[model samples]
Target: MMEFRSVQGSLIEAEAARNRARETRMRRALQRILTAAEGVPGYAPMNWSDVAEVAREALDADRPAGSNR
Candidate 1:
């Protein structure tokens, strides 16, 4: 049916948009890490695991308990 086709098309478009936004965020995060590490001594480039761990730590640090905002 035409209605079903329209819904499917919309879902596909939405998914594509989500994927693009995720990629943009990831690229920006990587750029930030690279910039932060630029002048540090004995520093090596990050791998995916390193990036994931750092991001997890950052997220955990930013969250506080007791009150929900």
Candidate 2:
């Protein structure tokens, strides 16, 4: 019915927003890695997983243990 259609539309919109946010994150992460490697010697390009892993490690290191989010 109409209610079902509304729900489906809302779900689609939410998914689109989520996709956009993910794309933005990926772009920003790539920019960070590229900027970091710009002047370094023997710099090699990395895949998304590699950059994400590096980012995650940095974030973890910055946070104090047993700290609540």
lDDT of each: 0.68, 0.71
User: Candidate 2 residues 1-69, lDDT tens each?
Assistant: 999999999999998997786666666666768865674556666667877786775455435698764
User: Which pairs clash (backbone N, Cα, C closer than 3 Å) in model 1?
Assistant: none
Q: Report how far residue 49 has shifted in candidate 2, in Å.
A: 12
TM-score of each: 0.58, 0.59
Q: Name the best candidate (by lDDT).
A: 2
Give the TM-score comparing model 1 with the true structure, all chains together.
Answer: 0.58
lDDT of 1: 0.68
- Candidate 1 Cα misplacement greater than 4 A, ranges: 40-54, 57-69
- RMSD (CA, Å), candidate 1 to true, equals 7.6
Query: Given candidate 1, what's the lDDT at residue 62?
Result: 38
